[model samples]
Target: MVDRVAARAHETIDRVAAKAGPAVEKLRESASTYREQLHAKADRLGALEEQWIDSARSYVREHPFTSLAVAAVAGMVIAKIFSSSHHR
Candidate 1:
């Protein structure tokens, strides 16, 4: 009886280990896929940043005074909005 019970327990452990092995492998596969997706997104973001930098530099060179005036006005508006909201 003791030998039978031990064998049964070992069998149960083996069964659980077998199930867990596949689950772990699937999780690893999913992580690898997510890493690939993130790399693709990072590449796209890099291209977008380069595009924006080139556009911004060109705009600054073309309209330095206009850009500075617009920036100053926008900053003043934002500061006023925040300052008023915080006071309230």
Candidate 2:
């Protein structure tokens, strides 16, 4: 009787493991696919960022005075925000 019970327990464990194996494999494949997609998106975003930086450089060079005025206004706004936060 004990031997039969042990055999039955072993069979149950094996069945459970078999069922779990395919589920685990599917999960691994899904994770790998997601990782690849994220890498592709990051590469595209990096290229876009480089393009924008180059465009900005050209614009700044062509209109230095305008860029300076914009920078000054932005700096003042940032300073005002920080100063107000500090007072609070």
lDDT of 2 by residue, 1-88 (tens): 9999999999999999999999999999999999999999999999999999999999999999999999999999999999999999
Q: Write the per-residue lDDT of candidate 1 for residues 1-88, one digit (tens) a residue.
A: 9999999999999999999999999999999999999999999999999999999999999999999999999999999999999998
Cα TM-score per model: 0.84, 0.92
Cα lDDT for residue 77, candidate 2: 100
lDDT of each: 0.99, 1.00
Candidate 1 lowest-lDDT run of ten: 63-72
For candidate 2, give the lDDT of residue 83: 100
lDDT of 2 at 56: 100
